[model samples]
Target: QLERGNLRTSWRKEHGHLRRAPVRASPLWNAKQRSVAAMRARVSRRPHRPSAKPKPAVSPLMLALVCCLCLFPPCLIWLLWRPSLGQRSWFRSPSPLPPPSPLAPLGEGNWTSALFLGDSSFVAAVHAAGHAFDAELVDERRPPLLVTVAEKADSPLLQNFLQSSILKHELRHWLVVALDSGVCEDLPDDVQWMACVSVPAQQEPADTAEPAMARPVNVKAQVLWATVKLGYDSLLVDTDVAFLQNPLPVLADYDRAHQQVRCGSAGAEPFLPHYPWLGAHVAESASTCESVIDLQAQRDEEHGIGAGFMRVKATPGGLLLLSRAMALSLKAPELTLQQSVSQAVGQLRGVITANTLPPATFPSRLVHLARPSRVFAYHQPCPKCVVVHSSWLTGHAAKVWRMKDQMLWSLDGPKKYYSDPKRKYIEYSNPSSMASQEAELNALKAAFMLGAMLDRTVILPEFRCHRCPTADGKGTTPKCSDMVTRCSLGAFGQLDLAKFAGAIPEDLFRERMFRYNPLTPKSAWGGSLFDSPVHLSFDSGKGGIGSLQASPEPGWEIQSSRAPEILSGAEVHPDNVLTPAADGSPTEDEVVAWFGSQTAPVLRFEHLYGLRPQFRHPARASAFDAMWNRATGM
Candidate 1:
């Protein structure tokens, strides 16, 4: 008969949640009943052999000891054999593949790695890149490839990226925060690791102190070296770079060939050779090969690699190249990071197999969004370009504004048309082409619309007399006679009057005016036509009689004279020179006729506003006043 404890245990194993059932109706109970009846029947039918004195009932303790003896050896063997079985190759379950690393996952679809330095300015660039990425892939449903952005520990920019919606939406990933423990302290929770970099102390020249620009290069180099050591194929991107497409696919060819370093060009052309110039045998003794090549001479002949955007594999060779480059940067503090890296690559050409993206492919592949003049000379705008670096226009807001204007003009269908009626429109119907066109148009419209509104409403010029002489009498006093000359009319003739008549948005025109203003603060002005100073002097010998000088500040100086000088080549009116009314006031007809001869009077109006007194020539000024009042209601 089964022990109650054993029965309960067996029942529990089979159906742990169930309560024990009564044994009376069980099969085991029926079998026990039958066996007892059979034993009694056998005793009744046969003469019982004199039963030996009934064995003394086995003591419970003795029974238990016997049970232990039988089970112990097998249990012991099982304990030993089980572990041995686990150790055996055939018996053991396959060890589970290690949990994928969060930092660097290895797979065909694994995240693309990108590194950036600095904060606010770069953060803006990253945001711009994100925008471009969104625009480029709006219709596609593919998962966002992870992009790792690395910044200095305790960088405000890092905090911004962590808290930004850009990362939350899977558009970007904050993979690491690189720090120099000596220079910075405090690590945030969001990043996967704090990359500790040791920056060498700045060794300044005895003749002059170290340049401020050199410090960033040092920090960037050290961070890059540390990243490579950590086993990441890193793409070091400047804060000024924006992405229009995924650049990772472009590196596939190089990655497949096991190339250690792949660099983009600063100009339109690639600097490195097509195939490995040095064989494997030659690279083994790279130091000897370096001595044979004149790197400086090669750099002069070839377009140098752009350091702004470069990809370095995490292999030993890549790490060594980065280390060499970092050391070079520290040694040559005078050179830019790009120059230093170019020199390093040139020096180590034979030691390292590097590839450069072809120059012709640069525009269709990666564009350097530098100054328009610089970029336009080399980069041809197209839909296929993946990256843009706006670093060249960094602090120059005016240049940036002008770039926006150029983009708007490019997008504006009206502006693109030729005089030929046959070629009135360029139609693009392909989805990708349409998407790009729409994106550029949207960006242009978004950038300009707000400015257009403000220009039309808020920034109307207040027509107070800039030429009103102060009580000190130090500056020129405005006179009505100044307006009567043909020289003044000629100056007025040069102005674009339609610009102020709503042909150009007031804000844009104001920006243009402010750019022309010598006294306008560069920080305050949004744009400028002349990047540098332009000297202009009046020639009294010609039809021009006014003496004007640009101040170091934004305002201009016009020499006022009571007796207006008669210019030698001044165009004379056939009817009358002055054409003044009996009341010494210029008639409406005379004012109208004078202004009608002018082409665009916007600049001329500004000039007149600056040169004339507030109450000077009430009748003659009425036309301007009416126009200004009608447009601005001021």
Candidate 2:
């Protein structure tokens, strides 16, 4: 109450009011009075002191001097170690490799190795020719040379390679290294080739009971190393590979990218270093190089990069890598070429780097054969592939047949034999179902015999199989993993049907039946039997079992719905009759007398299931047996 009264007096004095009107002692007025009294009491208790003078500001020079004093030791230490500071990179890039020395002329140094023996001059001349031919390409983007080593046994394959290159206009850039005289003779006179006797001619001496020096499982590396060291980059390919396109342009891109790649950069992701097959290749893809599985000696070793297709540069690293590989191959003769190269790469991992060609564009057999599509026919799974290495599949015959089916074959010099107008053909369909491969083969034997007897080329049907047969059909049976689920004629029996008995390729039916064939007019084809000539239906009497009479009485009949039109035409003759025989072989003269008078270009057999024609003559019987073996290999 006293505090409120004092506050009310102070307020009245401040307002200068003489009359003391009733003033409200609100909470705000009482609080202000207490704060004023507290301040007055604090002031009353304080001791009195004189004010001190302000100190002067420190100079900029003094401030800088103090900072220097604090940092002197560290700065001195840094200055003393300044030389080593620049060597450490903050961004973590790879250490730059020493620049390679300029390539010298071939014979300048001790270029001869154990593999090459002493063929320095010969190799130098070969490289000079290669450089000259590459210069003729006029395109600087192309690789320096494309090379392959071949012997007499690989003549067909060499022919195939040459033919493919000629088609793609890449023949001029090729440099074939011949391993023997036979290969040299097989090569065209105009082709750029050289004979290298680096490998031993004879494996063993006749007098020695002991084994001889084990020859290299593959001499591809030695040839490649010898050629690359001759001062030019080279693309080494196997003879079995079919060049679908000029691979030099694609390989040149790889080479350029490889040249620009650093040891540890984002640009190196798409590229692989030299000799990539250090261990087993896992999860193969479009960009990866394939590893060859060596099955020799039942080893089944799946190591080493495929030597079939390699793009080697002439850098010091490249030379060193090939050198080590050649040395390893020489030391370990039992190792396959792929295995030797792989071992070398494993040893020289840090010393050198190489680039692997993308297997998608340069496919091996493993990549291509695994495709569900018809790879050999339509170039499926890799139509844009530059080169298709048809390795892994054994035998030259298999390679030849596959290439022919793909229409990449020029062994016959680009002639379309399947569509020849002068040729007369016999067509037949496969049985509705076959119990086994043997059953189908028996049917094939019947067709082949009929073709030989009638002197007409038999058209093959799509041969179905549970598993792909071995290339020659005489090797080990294929595993279940090699089974192609669809109708594949490649798995069919590989025989010289053309030589033993007249036969055409499966191109007729493979290219959408006879419609795609040029010999058969497109307008005449109405998707009926009428599209062809007379459709002869043989009658085996009751129960589909009876002996065919030599005379033309109900032996055969025209089964086509268009039989009237066919009969109206003069193409069919009365003697053009044949029937399935139950017993007894027909004489050659009687058989000819029965069906030799027909003038039709295409003989359509409705169903030749039970038709088994046999000759009575001993000579003819012997010939037929030989033909049978060639057809079915039974």
Candidate 3:
């Protein structure tokens, strides 16, 4: 995943109706992985083998050449010697430990108790955990932050879990939560976040036909709530989670200290004594909020525990240290806290733990962060997550299949069909007067496929235009230049970009790995990569939001066209039966708005609907989705 550069899309016409795209295969990520594997597979010592006999004689010419090479140091060095200086093994050395003292943090032979806590799924998961499902409800924010903020529709259940986390009585037992909806206002009491940009006038997607946008939206708050409450030692789980064998034995063992502290064990590894906190314990004082572990790392370095599958050591020492880490990590404004704790530990100087603990130990507590497979659900369960909850309705079946490859059994997938807009839990946005949802989705594809510009060989048969650039200020497709001839893929990405900059999509991302060892730094050319979702929403002027309703904007048209042929409402097996992701894109208009971050698009719609003073215009989910499918081969 190693890479660098700001890659964007640029399309050009080729042939009469087709255009070729350039998209090079990603760098040799596999080869780099093998390189790392070899490093890991280094043997303790070379294997002993029978000695081989030395060769006898060399020709006179060869001897003379060798003599000549020896006489000339530079030639001799080039021909007779290999360079070891810049290669992998000769003289690599780690810096000396200075700040944190070395100490044996954790080891095996420790003990722990187990517990489970979360929402409705908790009952089923607890049954799966081989434990009793029990916990009382308590409100987090007084008056409930949902109503307090402009969004009065926020759900109490989601609010409580997101801010407070599960109350688990089990030691080393984890709690889980799910993120089903969009984030609440990105606001936290502890951390101050400046406005990155004006929250675009809360825009709605094209399909949302209500007089208002849907209410009770808040994923960020839920994540923060679960994260800040981790001292209780619970892992958050998404509802669709499946389990493997009983994790009691593994949880118990995860609490011990590493027995080999002297063998280069450092930082938090010292704290994870094999049995608790991985066998490592914290200083007794770490139990208090006053203790602070300053964590520092490069911005490029990512360290955070996924909200799913967090673990705690059962021992008092392990719990104490974990609590300490949690206390400091909770300071992060976002819900991302785990990696923060790990980073903090890595930052410390090591006079402290340098004297203690080994780097790794046996039988690791494997907490599956994603969904588990089927067999585990049927036979036993693994506490991949200790608590489970979400911002919106958690996907039931997808959770099971998230990691199905490792599972032995499977659940009957959930039933999903062409949705009824009035159906609860299904959400949609409205289209703006300026752009169409279809236009926006296409814009996004234009941006994504921009990567196609890198490789000159691949082309899109759909693009059939060769309009030459014009000098006039007007921006419109040329008339005479109707179609194409052969064009270079590089011409799209590398040609004169200023002219089409506005028509180009700017928001693009690559997976995290592309920034690492495999791809060269120059491989990807976008800006930064994000782990969070970024979308453009349409806003017209409406308020009382509800998922099933339309945007709270007047003069807004959320149009949908009926399919030419009526398709049967039958389930499409594994796919439709399973209910694929609803994490949809911006409304048709937003796609057209891809010109600039803030600029709106220009397009016409027959009518508008939703918002105060509501007027009627047909805007249905099925119709819009149908139109969407036809416009883009989505």
Candidate 4:
């Protein structure tokens, strides 16, 4: 077959009649392509004809002039403005990632970290709170890291804050941004701290005419930026705050709703539920303006999120707010952190969404501190408050006292106070025999002073009142007492009581404290202490220690009097100073001896209405009067 084929092919080639192997066609296989190429060639060949007037060549000078004319303005502008270009970032570069945060290695799941600001002074507090969570048990969700910033490794304010938070809350995760050297050495090795040596010293605006980014609040803003930039949603909690319940869940719920609404409302009107950011003084009516941020700006500057207890998300709006606040703070050094944030929010209203924490869940010092009645009304049982911020008070000591009074203090030990077996407690009731609030108050004052002298924690008695302070705080509300207005302590009295609590050591008790104390003695349960828990057997309607037997006393008629009056054998004296001893009866030392003789864990008194302390030194009397005046707001 091969030979036959080869022979056929040869024959065909020789004869020029063999179906010659189909020759490859030209690349310009179509007539149209060939025609087009021919036309192009013909036109090229005929294009040598010169125009009647030939164009002149561009001179080097003219060319340079044209180029300069076109580019000079922009180049000059750029050169002149290049210095300011850094200030106006049209396209912001990614913020340099902070070295892995101390919070990263903690908790297993995604969790919001709690941020605190402090310095060297807070070292003790930080150490005390370092192991807020149990180390042995693995937490499915890590506790929020308590992050703080300080000017120096041992800044005083920061230290104070550490003390406050450590004592008040059992914090889990911890991270510290030590601005200066030695923090690592100062703090325990277990403490997770990052040294930020680059942080500039805080600058006072008065010292410099030009704005600087050295303000404490400004630095805080910068820290917030870095945190969110690292994808952390943080709870900015002041050290003064006390966690009654875990506030994270509440904050998380709000954040989830916030994100959901933001995501769901794309291309539609935003959902902004109005609540109080500062206090109830701000209006809650739905704003007519389309943007909530604008509405916030229009509201009083005093109103907005409380800087002390803020929930900062890592979302775009949150990041934008933080960045803008930081920039604004630098530009306007006079503005406070809260103010800068407000201004930034106003500017970013179009793109941002904000909501106030539910007041019922998160009560603040701003509203409750000024109005003591509200504190009791809404926060007494504190049925719903997740966290209580102890702020608006003047000093750290004052904040600590307030927390203790509210049964919110955690640093000393467990939440229970007056539980120490070594410590003694004195108990009394609103003298059922006394009819007037004034009489009852006098009794309370006497009891309080007596407790102080005895080194006992006075379990405060509930007042029997004809009228209670109205909820509005404007007037009295009548109780259902046979035709007369039956009342408990009035709002005014509560205010005075708050002052008293802040002024003194944690020596006095509110009914709630006694009722809530887990260590409350079984013998003390029968009395009608705020409707005793059903689990405790009730012996009588008398709450608290009312049912307990009164300590046996030979002489119950004790009256307070000045030493000079007693020494002079006279009743009247210029000084109001009174001793623990009864006037015309016993010496101060004798009085101490009498109380000291008692071996009882609790000394129950029938009533202080009739007992008048007899004598005291001038200094003692003055101190007593001061305490009395503060407690009564007289």
Give the candidate order by descending TM-score: 2, 4, 1, 3
Could you give candidate 2's per-residue lDDT for residues 1-634 as a string of tens digits?
8998898779877987567776577899899999999999999999997898775598778999999999988876675554334224342222332222334433223432433424565455454445442223322332355777777788878876776665446455466666667676666665543322324443322222222123424456656666666655666767887777776555544434333342235534435454243112321211223211111011112554666776666666666667676556555667777777677666765454543445556556655554433433432434466777776665676566566555456553334444444455555544334324554555556656666667766665555454553443334344434433333345554444333323333322222123222233223222334334322222322211132112112223223232333223323333244432433234456556765764455555533343345765679778767655654456
- Of models 3 and 4, which has the larger lDDT? 4
Tell me the tens digit of each residue's lDDT in model 3 across 91-134. Answer: 33222211111122232112111111133342333222222111
lDDT of 1 by residue, 237-261 (tens): 5433344445555444333332232
Q: Which residues of candidate 4, in runs, are more than 4 Å off?
A: 1-172, 176-215, 255-302, 315-317, 330-334, 366-382, 413-419, 429-445, 452-594, 616-634
* Candidate number achieving the greatest TM-score relative to the actual structure: 2
- The residue-by-residue lDDT of candidate 4 on 139-202, one tens digit each, is 1222333455554523433443444454334444444555566543444354333222223345
Estimate the TM-score of every prediction.
0.34, 0.58, 0.23, 0.50
**lDDT (CA) per prediction:** 0.35, 0.50, 0.26, 0.49
- Which window of 10 residues has the lowest lDDT sum in candidate 3? 138-147
In model 3, what is the error at residue 628, expressed in angstroms? 6.3
lDDT of 1 at 595: 34
Clashes of 2: 2
Report the C-alpha displacement of residue 382, candidate 4, in angstroms: 4.3
